[model samples]
Target chain A: MGLMETFFNLDVLHSSALALLEGLKLTITLGLTSLVTSFAAGLILVLGRLYGPMPIRVIAIAFIDIFRAIPLLVLLVLVYYALPFVGINFSPFWAAVTALSLVASAYAAECFRAGIEAVAIGQFEAAKALGFSWTDMMKDVVLPQALRLVIPPSTGIGISLIKDTALASVVAMPDLLKQALQAQAFYANPSPLIGAALLYLIILLPLVRIVSSIEERQKRAAGR
Target chain B: MTHQKATQPFIKITDLQKFYGQFQALHDINLAVEKGQILALIGPSGSGKSTLVRCINLLEQFQAGTIEVDGIEVKEGRNLNKVRAEVGMVFQQFNLFPHMTALKNVAIAPVRVRGISWEEAEKKALALLERVGLSQHAHKRPSQLSGGQQQRVAIARALAMEPEVLLFDEPTSALDPEMVGEVLDVIQKVAETGVTMLIVTHEMSFARRVSNRVIFMEQGRIIEDTPPEEFFGCGPKTDRAQLFIRSVLQGHPDAGLTAPLQVLED
Candidate 1:
């Protein structure tokens, strides 16, 4: 086959596009649930670090550091494979969700911590001066500012979570890549994988652009 | 919580001492302010003016001695929430939350801290924003405003707490040369309402014009506390005070009332 003929088969592309589209629901579902669960967990970690007791903060910190150090593939395997031996079995879907959330929250914690630390010392002083209770200080003053700052990097993490859904296929969750694999196996052609890669790019590129534009607008607003 | 309106000085600092890793930041600092006095603190950087102001509300803890605000003595386990609530501070950085609109910034303290309804606090915030000449920009974020406008919003935020005393730490020091006047005007208006103020500022002329007394500090100790008239105008008074006066007079030859006051730092 000619190089163009191999890389650009319309039949392969069409079949892959249809199959990947069929898998789209699982891909998006995993992405969104992982993003949310991990963000909630990350919030818990951040708050634990900020206001939790010293030992609790230490444990949370270790969790962040440890999860960040492990490979996501290795971590996914552990969740799906190792835990079942201990009778803490997670179904494939839960295993992927659990593993991705673990990885995502580690990054999310770092992002959130940076955002919180960016708030000035004077703010806490002012919060105290305003008669805010400790809870009120976090809810009213610190969290609002910190959350706004986290938006851009956070969206980047969201994009990463979406991309990471491909790892789910390794655990047999049958997401886009799996469908692409099945299509390629049936047709004895590998071009559908390239088409699948193209589809991933399609999903990611615009989200990155949107985050960049939001970042730009924030900078302009900050300048005023 | 119930007491007669103070016949005694509202804030009293008696032999207060603070140490920063064995370096003394405060040295037997004894000071007092009547309920309505506007005291201006002037010093070189690191002279502990900001530290002293912070100690008043226990924002910075002192190692030994007492700070009394509204007749309550500083104690480690004491409920300081009331004292803190009744004293407001404006920072050198303005410190308005950049993501928050001016109205939201001003309203947050009252609503969250005092448990006031948001609607009521926002109504008051709008009125206070107008007082500081920022009503038109209430919906804009702090990052959208000039330094002067942001500082005014900060003052309005402080005022929203209805503090018995307002503390300013070099409030206009970070401002552009042209923008200092508007913030100082808002502060001046706040002072006129008999709000006790302990201000740390480099604006000698503004200090002279607005403060009832000027305090000069060096090396964490007060060198002189004099009416602005005596503090700024002479030589050979004390070698240090004389040196300070010359520096001020030479640097700001037209600093006092004689020059048409432009709010510029120059």
Candidate 2:
């Protein structure tokens, strides 16, 4: 038999599909939890960097730079293994979330900062002239407009984070990649690896398309 | 002494000085505006006319003077929100909130700053828009409206705040010539309401028609401050003010016809 027949055996493909399906639920949950945590943290960091006092601004900048510089793999290792030495122990799932969110938040914060800065200074001046306090302006006018401007970039970040959840398998979280590896070992074939790639494609293709369309609409709205 | 000497001015500025890095933008300026008075400020570019108006509302800080708006002193580290809530400013660029409709732009401050109910704010905003002849366009955003229409909405927005004083910083200078008359007409109507106002403008005729007093500045110093008729009457005043009026009015033959300064010059 050809290599394709060996790899694409019906029995192996069926079993691989079943195993991967079981892992999808955990993968989705991991993606969602990390995304929400990262987005909220990112907003706070962006605001701190942009409008906070000197001490907070310095700390936020340092945090963003450090997280962005570290590889996700190293961060996961540090959170899962090294953190225990400091008497802080998190389960593997919590470890994956903490590590992924920290790294994702750094990138998202940059995206939010760029979006907020892109709004005209005149908007703030007008809001101030109307007697809006700093916090009021941010909540009522600035953030609403900035969020609209950032949708495409933030979606890009979200899609990247979803794919990065696969890295959780390193800490043995039994996510999609881990389940596929187990199937590969059991079946002694690479078919499960192919199935995992297809699953990623299925999840990410619609997200990528949505991001592109939003970018196009934004450009058109800007009269470019 | 002037008749205004009998009553204290609602807005007062004394020994005002402003600096931008190494450059001085305003110097030792003293001025006052009585309630129900309309004062016009006209000057060549870089003369700090706009800066002076900005200083009154605490939009620009002066280094050496005190500005009192309706008894609230303009100072750093004070609760400026109370002062701002009482002073409404109209900008050269209109500066309407682009994301909101005209009605919302006019209504938002009353709701957010004053804690007025949304229903009442919207109702009052609609009335203000009607006063500006923009009732039919209440739902339009700044980006959807013409420059002139947007400015009218801005005026209505300022009016909705029920401010003690209104400051216009060259409100019509950014409009096309044909569009200027509509905005000026709306301002004239606003003036008729007897609201205290300070206007910084280049429209000499409108300044003469609507203002009780006109102030001319050069190099950050007030060259002359007098009644509009006297300021434009070719009487004894700063030569710089005379040259500025002449240059700005050069193309219009019928300029100053009502207050014929040319005859006085001859």
Candidate 3:
């Protein structure tokens, strides 16, 4: 077959577009769910690591270090394939989300820690001297400032998590990449896979632009 | 002196010794402050002026000390908020919450810590902004205000707590030269309200004018503690304090030695 027929066949892409759309919907759902879960889990983990008593801090540190070091694909396979042998069965979707959140939460925790530490010591002293309780200080003073600082990095994590949703296909979750693979097999053409890549790009490009603009704005704010 | 009815001092520090990992920051410090008295702490840098003020509110833990604020003995593991609520502090950095408007900065502690209604706290906060001559700037964030205005807001924030004792740790040290007068004016107003104040300052003229007592410290020890008139006029009893004062006078050359010397005649 010629190159266009093999990889860029419009007819094949048009025929498979509906199936790809269904997969894209699932991918988005998975990505959003994991994004929220990981972000929240990251916050809790960071708080524990920074403020909790000895055992919780140790456990949080271990969890962050181990999950951050593990390969996502290996973790996905382990969650989907190994856990069933141990009498714990998660559906493909839950398994994918579990694996993605575990790894992404570790990254998110580090980002939050960096942001919190970057807050000036004077800010903490001011809050403390005002007689703010620890919880109130974090909520009203420290976290608000830290949240602004972590936006660019955290959004970078979110984008990577969305792209990682493609890895869900390995566990039979029928996400975008899996659907693309099926369409390619049925049509005997690679155009469906290229079309799936294009769809991912369509959704992600704007987010990438937003992250850069936010970073640019923060730099400008800092410069002033 | 109207608030000095209690027989006991409002704040008492006994044998206060502070350390930072084997480096002593304060040594054998004992002091007493009566209610409504403004005591200015003067010393070289690293002489524990800031550390001593911080210890009163338990912002810095001491290795050995008994600091009693308004008769409550400060200690570790005690609820520091209880102590801090009664002792407001103004920092050199101003340390105003950059994210908040000046009004919110002044009002937040009262609303959150004192459990006052937001509406009431804001009203009081506005009055405080007016007192500091920044009522028009109340809506601006710290980033929008100049350093002096920010420090005034900081003083207003501290005053909103209605603290019995106020600590100013080089309050005007961080401002541009032109801005110092405005902040000092607000501090003078606060001092007039008769809050017991411990001020760590390098402004010799301000210390001589505003504080009743002047303390000269060096190497973490108090070398001179006397009435501001005596300390700045007859000059300090200790040679160390005398030398320090002479150097300070030489640097500023306008710290108003003549005024304090005139006070000696009166």
**Which candidate's lDDT is highest?**
3
- What is candidate 3's lDDT per residue for B1-266, written digit by digit as tens? 12334798888899999999989999999998888899999987788899999888788989987988777788755567888888899999999999999999999999999999999999999999999999999999999999998999999999999998899999987888889899888888888988889999887888888999998888889888899989878878998887777666565334322212223333
Q: Tens-digit lDDT track for model 2 on B1-266?
A: 12234467788888999999889999899988788889998877788999999887777877888987767678755568877888889999998888899999999999999999999999999999999999999999888899999999999999999987899998987888679899999999999999888999877778888999989988899989899879876542878777777766563332222222332332
Candidate-wise lDDT, in order:
0.84, 0.87, 0.91
Worst 10 residues of 3 chain A by lDDT: A126-135
Report the C-alpha lDDT of model 3 over A1-224, residue by residue, as the tens digit: 89988889999999999999999999999999999999999999999999999999999999999999999999999999999999999999999999999999999999999999999999999988888989999999999999899999999999999999999999998999999999999998999999999999999999999999999999999998
Single out the weakest 10-residue window by summed lDDT for candidate 1 chain B. Answer: B255-264
What would the per-residue lDDT of candidate 2 be over residues A41-154, giving only the tens digit for each residue?
999999999889999999999999999999999999999999999999999899999999999999999999998998887687778788887888998889988989999999
Candidate 3: pairs in clash? none
TM-score of each: 0.87, 0.93, 0.95
Q: Candidate 1: TM-score?
A: 0.87
lDDT (Cα, tens digit) per residue for candidate 1, span A1-224: 98766777788777677787877778888899999999999999999987799999999999999999999999999999999999998988899999999999999999999999987787777787667788888877888888888799999999999999999999999788888888889877878877788888888999999999999998997696
Q: Mark the regions of model 3 whose C-alpha exceeds 4 Å error after superposition.
A: B1-5, B252-266
Clashing pairs in 1: none
Candidate 2 positional error at A128, Å: 0.6
Write the number of the candidate with greater lDDT, choosing between 1 and 2: 2
DockQ of 1: 0.57
Q: Stretches of candidate 1 above 4 Å error? A: A1-19, A215-224, B1-8, B73-78, B226-239, B252-266
